[model samples]
Target chain A: MKKIMNAPDAFVAESLEGLVRAHEGLVTFGAGRTFIRRRDLAPGKVAVISGGGAGHEPLHSGFVGRGMLDAACTGHVFTSPTPDQIVAAMDETDTGAGCLLVVKNYDGDVMNFEMAAEMAASRHAIDTVIVEDDAATGPSLRSRGRRGIAGTVVVEKILGAAAEQGSNLAALKTLGDDLNRRIRSMGVALRGTTVPENARETFSLGPDEMEIGVGIHGEPGLERTRFAGANEIIRLLGERILAEFPSDVAEGGTARPLLIVNGFGGTPPIELYLAQGIAHRFFENHGVVPARTLTGTFVTSLDMAGLSITLALLDEVQFKLWCAPVATPCLSW
Target chain B: MKKIMNAPDAFVAESLEGLVRAHEGLVTFGAGRTFIRRRDLAPGKVAVISGGGAGHEPLHSGFVGRGMLDAACTGHVFTSPTPDQIVAAMDETDTGAGCLLVVKNYDGDVMNFEMAAEMAASRHAIDTVIVEDDAATGPSLRSRGRRGIAGTVVVEKILGAAAEQGSNLAALKTLGDDLNRRIRSMGVALRGTTVPENARETFSLGPDEMEIGVGIHGEPGLERTRFAGANEIIRLLGERILAEFPSDVAEGGTARPLLIVNGFGGTPPIELYLAQGIAHRFFENHGVVPARTLTGTFVTSLDMAGLSITLALLDEVQFKLWCAPVATPCLSW
Candidate 1:
């Protein structure tokens, strides 16, 4: 595996070190490197926190700032953060209003965040909003249900805005849960990622084949099919996501959902934007125009060459939350 | 070649289509498809325009908005924009104060911009600033000296800010030229890029090899040597780039030049940020601290897995220009 690093074991820590240094004024190390803390912590506001594996970068950490996450507990690549780390994040960031844990629907993540909540049960009034927006996996595929993927950005954006606007922990949790149910995402992988610690490729695909419905952690999808053109690939992913959305949002024939074409690390912006164009046309044909579109490497799996499509149906409240001012390292408007 | 594009021939057009569609309120297609025009073009303000091959995302195109370029001409991938395209861009954006053309120093780009400037000689007061900051090449390598690369972003940013502040074309040209002289950049490629039209890999390297000082277009650099760890590799590139700087700027013990660690497509954010940390340490060890650092996939060779480092010495005026607000899709502050 041709990966860039000094010591493979120090990959996650070094990357975190660089991130904090680069975004000095925005974020800093929190409670002993257990999490990244936003610089401006408005007391009495709800503390929004989230974390998962380290590879899907600029996710939880990059989202830490004045209008996003208050703190982001980081785990190793594709691994869950220890309950101790989550506790540290909570201990350091929770305001009197309380805390909202934005947990992705993964076995390890759910369990760890739950454990952390239990540990902090006495001091903080906390609520959890689990994101399970991946359309590929569900109760039929795995008993655990869908694994959260790129739609987490939408969840974070909306929830963070709500938190910043003085929403209580319970209200933020309700908002996050509603947003999660409205969003659906699916991805295709042209290549797999090499996990830096062991230097092992999470999965491999033939040169002329692609993985359909792949997760962000380089997990194999439902099908390993022959390679196809960009339009066909995006169509497959888009169709899956649309099918999973509520009929009112997907079949409304006129409502324009927020569409996101998120790159999986290796895919460049040019291709992501091209895919966005194809996706817009595909949705327009289905009578749903993706009016608010975002294209970039927001969520990634190391060096995996692929992308995920996310669609979120936002009401006036959700749209207002998204439009609120935000200043973070990876995202701001 | 594994690329997310439909009908390689339409790669550039499709990407531009997505860009304009995504940034509807900020920009639109000018007169023809030849250029992207800023939607809020201030009448009588100096029109800052730039164009180049289309592979670099957010480069000339993504930088068009308030406090940035008034227009950006688009060319085919890795190919210069035709003189006609530049002329169209100038015709659409030139205000009474005139237009400033920001051209990258390439045989084709310089020639085309010069021809367009001559063509508009009577109608608009056009001044051209050609950027040539690649540290790996000079008189010994090619008659044209160094080729322009990632540093073009800085040039556009500073000039764009000055233009927005109502600087005339002549003043902007002088500022741009002086900024160009103070920046030096160098890159290394772990893998090469395949030009999409013909599916041609611009250059090739063995599994255990790397190319040093590689240009952004997949052009072979100063050497192709065995692969090494990230620290040693950054040290070599850092020393070479530092040698090209003026003695006063580089040799001064306390001065800090703005450092840019730019990725060439395939490398993900984790690795890029890690490299940035290393590059910072390397520069500090050489007695020159890189206080202002910008790291991202700014300038790219399509899907090439590598990165470049650029250091620009900014005086107080230039620093303030860098601090000016820019509301573009790719970059904003």
Candidate 2:
């Protein structure tokens, strides 16, 4: 790839500096350019924070705002943020309300956030919520569970909005748990992306093949299928997602769900919208009453050619909270 | 150029359905599949709306919410939305509040939205704000300016927030006009992205050459330079953007402008951050204190391999409103 940089090793630090400079109003850095919130925290408000490798643009930092995360810990590209970085962000944004750590269900991310949460709990009543949104990542009832993908943003936004509205840490944790159960996501990658530092491709794909239900870090998806239009692709993915929801939920007696169609980096908005269209039709065919839908590159792989669809069943309270105001780099209220 | 689609023609409708299915809480569509806001509009709010080609996700539709846009029109990939579609959205979202049409600097988008505004204004006090945010496009002093690119999003968000805060159509139009002066964006493309329907490349570039200051529709950038690292790329692009700002603006105490490092589709987050780092260092060296910075794929070129940088100089009011609450599919408040 034709990239401009002084040195490959210097990319992360320089990039973080650029992020801080660009979002100075909402983001800042501590020692070693570790990410932190720019605002002064009110005393006694629990600081909910999360972070991961730097490659995901809006993942940790993009989510730092009023109705979302208080701060994010950033690591190197496609690598987990260090425990020290997470601890720093927690210290910077922590209020007596105690901090909640929202982590993706990735092995590295889980281990790192888990260690940080344990450290925070040792210091205070810090709580944590690990989001396992990607159904493609893990077995339903086994080791580690699903890998967290784009759904982390929804979890953080929903929970962060609740926290901003002054929900107690315990209450927020309960809300997080409940919301987690109601959400599920799956992705497909048509092509691979490269990590600049490595200067090598992350994964390989046949010219005519797509790996459905792929992972964000370039892990293999559930199955390989011949390339198809977004409609067919989404139908297959939505059927799998709908299968996970309670049949009663699909029947829509009393519940409506929020849908997210997220692009895995190189996928364009045009393609995402097409995917959204197909998914919407699938829901209508299934007799589900949709509440709200989001389509875009919310969470992403580093220019991977793919997308993920995440569904969150929202009650009135969740809906209202989701609508609350927020200010961060990537998203607002 | 590997894609997972059955045919190009089915991309848009299928994608829209999938998006609604994925995000039923935030968006809804008419029987004909026109995307709209989930909430009903008040009778006296000026219905500000915009849309163009399908690649620019979250621009028209994502900006629809409280304190932002009322509704958006969608088009096929890189194509302007039909006038009928724009009219339909206006009728649904516009109450007594006169509608404001915010069109990018593109010839197609401008002509289409203008025609629709004229049609709507005959019945209502519809006004329009033409955004020439891409300084690289419509000549600053010429009748025809540069095509609006990613910077259009900033203009739309700021004006939309003002409208949500009860600004009338006239006031919102003025804000939009003022934003056009305060905003400037320039983009670069390393590679051209192919539309799924075409299944063929839209533009071509040498494997080692990068197009700087390129237009969104795959037009060549200001320069086709040898690809370098992030720092070098930032220097090349930053000089143009900084120079575009009048010496008085840069010299006069502006509130350090907001910086947007937008990807032209296929560029990876790592590369964007690397570019962002370079941009930040350039600003730091120049003593330009950026008030806010956003780095992501805002306006995209199908899957083009490049990124753009946008600077929006905000006055106090615009700054506060920029931080206001919003809810949309792609962008949150």
Candidate 3:
């Protein structure tokens, strides 16, 4: 695989080093470079932390700054961070108002974050909010329920704002849980990502076939389908997400959805914007006017050519929190 | 050529439609969707307008909003917009303070923008600032001197803020010219982008070879070499750019450079951040501290897997202008 790196094994560490160096004013590395924390953490505020694999950049690390995440523990590409790393993040970010851990619903991630919370409970108040917003995985197939995907960004944004407003640990956890249940995401991948250590694509597909409902980590998608136009792909993803929305949010026609057209690393912004437009029109035709829309590469796999559509049913308070000002490396408004 | 497009020929128009719809509150399309302008155009401020080929997104179009370009005209992929479109942008954006056209130094772009300036001269005051910062082609190679590349983003950011601060058209033109002359850039491409109309990659390369000094529109680069590590590639590009710096900016060692590690669409954020680290060290080793560094996919060539380095020597005033607040769909600060 062609990639810009010094050594395959050192890719994640070196990239993290580069990130800290590039945004020195906004973030800093922890004791062992296993976690990153905001440079200026406010006292008496609930600390919000999140992490997963390293490939989905601007997710955990990039969100660590003012009005967002207080810290993030990072793992190697498509791998979970160790419990020790999660503890490091918690120790560095807890400001007495307590700490909130936003963990994606992956087996490894859930276990590690839970262990970290147990480890940190003696010294500081810590709580975990598990996010499982992916609609592609049915309830019967997996005991872990749906895997968290791009909707994690929405959860992070809302919870980050709520935490910054001096919300206690329990309040922030409740907010995160509520938002996670309201959000749903699904993706389509045209190509697979190449992990540096493996030096090979995670999967392969026919030239005219696409993996619908693909996971961010190149997990097996629901099915292989014929390649089609943007509108069709968007419609399929939208229909699945809308079908699974809570009946109160879906049936009453009073749902004010917040749309996120997330690019899966290698997709260009032009196509993402086009997808956003298609998704917006589709929602409008179905009698829903989105309250807010965010279109960019918020979450990604390593050089994967695909995208995900996320819809979060928003209440007035949640919508207000989503619109709250944020200052981070990847997101600032 | 796998792309998220409705139809090959409809790509540009449809993409623009999506852009306008996605940023409905911030921007609006001119007559016939030929140009996009900020909705809240301030009267009596110099209007900065920029455009070129359509493929390099988030460049001209994404830069339109507060503290940036007042309007942008888009052409087909890798093709220049017509004079009529440029005229339309000028007519819609020009206030009492006149208008400034920021055109890259491509043959078609320069010619078309020049013709549009002449056409619009009958009604409104219009001036043009040509950007030619690429150091790949020597002065003697082509009459056009050098091709404009990613440095155009830097120019727009500075000039956009200057215009917002009520700089007149003449002053904005001079500032753009000064900054263009001081800036130098070089790029490397791992893959060629596929133009929508062509339905084929612009060029091909051996699996282990990379094109250095590649142009935004997939123009041939200076050389094809075996792929190397990130540090080596960055050092090579940095050396070329630093070597071509004007005597004043290079000799005194007092120059505060603004660095832009721009992704060519397909390169992930991890690689770009790593590149930024290497570039930062390269400059520091040479006894220069970058006053400001912006790293992201600001300028891009569709889905080309590569990146470019732009170093613009900055005076205190220009650096301040660069930090000014601006909000747009793709960019916010």
Q: Could you tell me which 10 consecutive residues in candidate 2 chain A have the lowest summed lDDT?
A: A245-254
Docking class of 2: acceptable
Candidate 3: give the TM-score of chain A.
0.97
Q: Each model's number of backbone clashes? A: 0, 55, 0
User: Residue A44 CA error for candidate 2 (Å)?
Assistant: 3.9
Candidate order by TM-score, decreasing, is 3, 1, 2
Stretches of candidate 1 off by over 4 Å are A248-256, B251-256
Candidate 3 regions with alpha-carbon error over 4 angstroms: A252-255
As a TM-score, model 2 comes out at: 0.82
Q: Give candidate 1's error at residue B328 in angstroms.
A: 1.4
lDDT of 1 by residue, B1-333 (tens): 878888888898999888888888899999878899898788889999999998878688988998888888878898999889989988888868899999888898999999998988999998988898998987467887788999999999999999888888889989998887788999999988888888888998898999999987777799999898889889888889888876776655434478898888898888888888888888778776766888788888888898899988788788789879998878888
Alpha carbon deviation, residue A185, candidate 3 (Å): 0.8
Better of 2 and 3 by lDDT: 3
DockQ, ranked from best to worst: 3, 1, 2
DockQ of each: 0.74, 0.48, 0.75
Scored by CA lDDT, what does every candidate get?
A: 0.86, 0.75, 0.87
- Evaluate model 3: give its lDDT: 0.87
Question: Among these predicted structures, which one has the highest lDDT?
Answer: 3
